[model samples]
Target chain A: MATQQTQLLARTLLTPAVALLFIWMIVPLALTIYFATLHYNLLDPGSESFVGLENFRYFLTDPAFLASLQNTLVLVGSVLAITILLGVPLALLLDQQVVGLSIVRLMVIAPFFVMPTVSALVWKNLLMHPVSGLFAWIAHLFGLPAIDWFNDAPLFSVILIISWQWLPFATLILLTALQSLDEEQKEAAEMDGASALSAFIYITLPHLARPITVVILIETIFLLTVFAEIFVTTGGGPGLQTTNIAFLIYSQALIQYDVGSASAGGLVAVVLANIVAFFLVRIVGRNLEA
Target chain B: MARMVTTRHKVISTVAAWLVGFLIFFPILWMVLASFKTELEAFAIPPSFLFFHWTTENYVTVQERSDYLHHALNSIIIAGGSTLIAMLIAIPAAWSMAFSPTKRTKDVLLWMLSTKMMPPVGVLVPIYLIYRNLGLLDTRTGLVFILCLGNLPIVIWMLFTYFKEIPKDILEAARMDGATIGRELIYVLTPMAVPGLASTLLLNLILAWNEAFWTLNLSTLEAAPLTVFIASYSSPEGLFWAKLSAASTLAIAPILVLGWFSQRQLVRGLTFGAVK
Candidate 1:
């Protein structure tokens, strides 16, 4: 029995975290919402005025906003697709009986640990550089021209780098989920004349559904705000080719010093992320209840 | 079914998996190898895979050139300080929720998880202004405070999950023996919580170390962590492939090792125990 004394003590213990998180969540956000309504530019200070809905209107109407919005969706959608699609097969393969599984796993998952900047730059210079990158050499080996990655397809390049960073994460989670699958169930499927492909499609896919949702939601949360990789690789460069909402807001706030519009964009980002978080919290909460 | 797959099938699967693994890992591997090469060799067309003139010069140069150690120290201070502070605030809270969960415990935990979903960009403008006005910009304390708050939810959540798994019978038994609450925690609870605490620390440290948004926005040169420092190399310095590789390698090596060690915990931590 949880004594009343212990419950009191527990509430006391929880207060600091609760109080701090409450402030952490509410204070800046309240400020952001407040700032979103004003025509405040940092460089032209002391002329702040309430310009209700103007910032949001401008932020929403700006062509760059539309481009960055599209870019954000593409970045998130592509990385999610790439990671999940490849991750499933990779997880299945790793789940198979294999030699040096530990070493293979370490090598496979190594990229997930690499810092975003490092992975982005490494892929940019050493692997994808059109001039002297490894891909150039590989292209030369086949007597084909080197396709400039960042220059030609900056958004795709960003997507590739992010997908690489996240694929390992997807695989590791799915593999962990896979290892817990009922071997008896698999054997039964096999005995019932299910081929490997059918067993995987019918049994394995169903088994992976929850973890797949977990991976997608978790990855979407991170992917939607992907910053460092784009920052290092493209700097949202070549005229907003790779600019996502995060970078767009950063440039607006810190670069252009437009507090009002940046705050508006920030709110927009908050709303977008909350849409995803709504589903994620529900799913994770369901798991908690279970 | 396991026996139905022949040795040949096993061998084929092994080869394919290893190839895929190596392909996935090639970028990091190439970076490491490039770190050991002469700058010219690092960028040579028809690149030398293994026979390049190996050098430790890039590692020496990366430090001597950019003061790599300074940024690395900032990373350590920021990541370590945040994780430490987070754990201190989180431990008791997680302990309470685990041991004496009330009707609101689940709601509280879910609410904490929701805070993590608040995109950092949403609050970036205000936080930036707040830091500027308070003159906390480019300070380790600023970075540490933000990162600690940013990660506090996950720290509490992960610790809660771990602490929940800890059997309450032991605590009840200690209570039945007339042990005081403090003594019960000291003598009965902490030892069991160590593994969970360590893994949580490791995971949080890794997350904080690689954290980019706040560190990038709030700090410049003085408190710049490796993330910001490495981002500086994105321009002219990035063209120097070997040096870039050396800097990147050094920046990631510690977190990589820590990450590998904590990989198991990572799934639980990142997924908020949804997968587990």
Candidate 2:
């Protein structure tokens, strides 16, 4: 009796949000599918024609479409790898009982809260400018030529900036996980004459598995759809070198005025994201309980 | 020999820690410094750390170049308004799930989280159409509604974790005192959960403030916030380093101050569910 009542109450409480999101999901998707089969362009609004799967066929075969899919994967993968590698070491340092550690923590987390566009702009202009940026300044200081980060290396530059911002999140979570490690266990390990490196390998690394997974999953979801960095840094280019899937879709709809193709592309991106999200759901669901 | 090695290890770790911390913070520090430089001095080779001529000309130029105050105000309104709205709805919902949860409550929570995992671009087309059709494009109201709805799940999750620790018997006692549901929520639950709520609010406000995607995509002139304001420095011709820094410094200043003041609460809030 209690179980049934709670289920009903749960449904009642969750219904509003679930229903709203369901509509939010279904309505766009329905339009995209409907539009995909019909000829629709923002430029040619009055002319409507049923064209089944032609948009998808066009999008799939488009060279830019293929480049965008590859770009999205590269961006997400590189950011994930860099954040974990940098973040784990950073987390270990922040976990130390150093003086002024509190201030250090705040400084570390400051970047994560900077608006993405702002960060990208800062990186592009102040840091990465070939002639005038601090990077240019530094290379001159060392008597070397400056490299144009956005022009020559737009994708890597985006990856680097995004990882820099997200590094703190992974670090903070890992720091929390590190702090929760039992002092007694560490003391026993020390007493047994285990080296610090070995102790981390045997004990601390295992403890951090969950947080590491959480960081990767959460960051992946955000990174796959990263827009502002490219939007600000290179506008996804020195000619599509940095255009990820999200940027590709935005450019199609807003810049190219191809609503049908963009909708078809959006649906494809959604399906790919769902496949990634299905795994994320399993990982996140195992931990969250009321 | 062992003691000497330990001392060396300590020194090495301290140096490494400070070096990494400084690197992580260098971009922001560079922006602040660049904000005070003249455009020519800002571009100087061998980067004048302190020897360059100092001027607030860039800041002045930035202020005169754009509507600084208006973008700042738009940012404050959208971030503060969305966070406030999210909190107001989430608190009650989180309370119900935490204290009076039914068998399906966990499933509901999981489902909410799953929505967050879906790529935002997936729904962009339809939402654009919705906003366009409803005349909500480039409006603060539109931005506020989307942000609140977008972040509701996170707000609820954070509050639910905090609310779980409160004894159910306390609310029961308030009920015995003939306090109404609203009174119990406002006076009883709100007070008891103050730390949790305050931290949640602050974090959400920061997150909302920094959200760039939807704000940029949906907004132009009248509704565009600081993110767009900063992005404007990025031109198709090339970037202006000094001016961009000026805009970035202006954009991040308020949130950095908020973050400095609320460090402890932010730390505690971030660590709440993860540590457990």
Candidate 3:
């Protein structure tokens, strides 16, 4: 009887959080879906007529949409590739018995904590600036011409900044996974006259598969909505070269005040993200059980 | 098992690892170095690594130009307020779920996690309109509310994971000893859950401090945090590299220290316990 009473009390305690999250998730999302089908402009208040699928048609067919969509894919894909590729070797390197290991680990993980705006500006002005940046100084020393990073390659520059921020996360996760590798299995493989390359390929690579997937999925979710870096450095410009979908919708709703189309675009982004989220939730859900 | 590695191998790995670490950390190191230099010296060719005459003028100038303290206070209130509020609601929820999990507990937990996966942009339009109508835009309260909601799932998840690690036998023992629910919670659970709560607080505070997207979009001046404060230097009128660096340094230094301390919890919290 006492246990039954406590269970009811537990349900009561859980109500506030559950209720708030329910409203937070449902209300605005329903509003977004509703607004996506209407001709709503924030600037012209009191003029929101139902427009059916017209807003979606316009947003999906716009050339800028295609460009931003491509930019989103390229940015997410390139950053994931760079982080994971570099993260593997770096994690392996860090896993080795090295002097001052904690200090080195701190250095590697420092960039992940720097806020996006600061990192973007620091990279833009101090490091990637054309004439006076560190890259220019390095090029001059090597008798090479300085590359104007933003002007010549805006998306690539954004990728580099973002990659720098996320590389630490990948390294830390992979390093943790690496440390958990069964040493006995590796020793057994080594005693069987397996080469170092073969041992790593056979043993270490397999062990890393799960973590690498987790890294890829988590990074993709954040990478899909990388806004602050673009907002600070490129401003989605030099002719929309750096505009991803997140910035694209931002420009639509805030800059252009086209709420109808922006909401439509937002729904599209949500759909795209849900595809990735489905897999991520499954992976995490399975882990929750164990 | 300790494999015998040659001294040369160890030396090579050490050198290579340190070199990579330095290269990765160079941008931040360069920013900190430039913050102490003059405008001209900051952009000097060959980019002085450390030999420049160091000064605190840029820090003073940045403060004078923009009221750094006001924005810093806003950051403190927003991050700190939202975290405390979320913890208040999340603790009871997570505690109950952790201790008295029902048949639907996993489903509820997964549902909460799913809310986090929804892109902020998906609901940006509605939230903006709602905020505008409610007169919450550019207000610290508004930001705090949204941030708390935004991070509520994380706070709950983290606390739940931590709470699960606490053996249930103690709580049951307390109950058997004629302890009331309130007394059990106050004297027993709270003390035992302190470390986990502290880490959760630390990780969430760092997250709230560095959240940039909503802060950038929703705030202009009144409730602008350090993120907005630093972003204002993007299109400078004159030579302001030193001041920019100084401002950027101030914005990130506190959170960076906090982040390093919570690096272990970060992986577990972020990955939803998948990696850990």
Q: Put down candidate 1 lDDT per residue, B1-276, tens digits, no spaces.
A: 666667878898899999999999889989999999998899888899999888999999888989999999999999999999999999999999998888988999999999999999999999999999999999999999999999999999999999999998998899889998999989889999999999999999999999988988888899999999988888884359999999999999999999989999999999999997
Order of candidate numbers by DockQ, starting with the best:
1, 3, 2
- lDDT scores in order: 0.94, 0.81, 0.94
Question: Candidate 3 lDDT (Cα, whole model)?
Answer: 0.94
Top candidate, metric DockQ: 1
Give the poorly placed runs of model 2, Cα more than 4 Å off: A1-19, B1-8, B176-180, B236-240, B260-276
DockQ metric for all predictions: 0.83, 0.51, 0.81
Q: What does candidate 2's lDDT look like per residue over A1-290, in tens digits?
A: 64466556645665665666566556767877787776777788888798889999998999999999999999999999999998998999888756567777778888887889878877877788788778887788788988888777888999999998898888877887788899999999999999999999999999999888877767777888999998877887878899999999999888887877888888888888877777767765666642
Name the lDDT of candidate 2: 0.81
Can you list the residue pairs that collide in candidate 1?
none
* Candidate 2 true-interface contact recovery: 0.54
Of candidates 2 and 1, the better by DockQ: 1
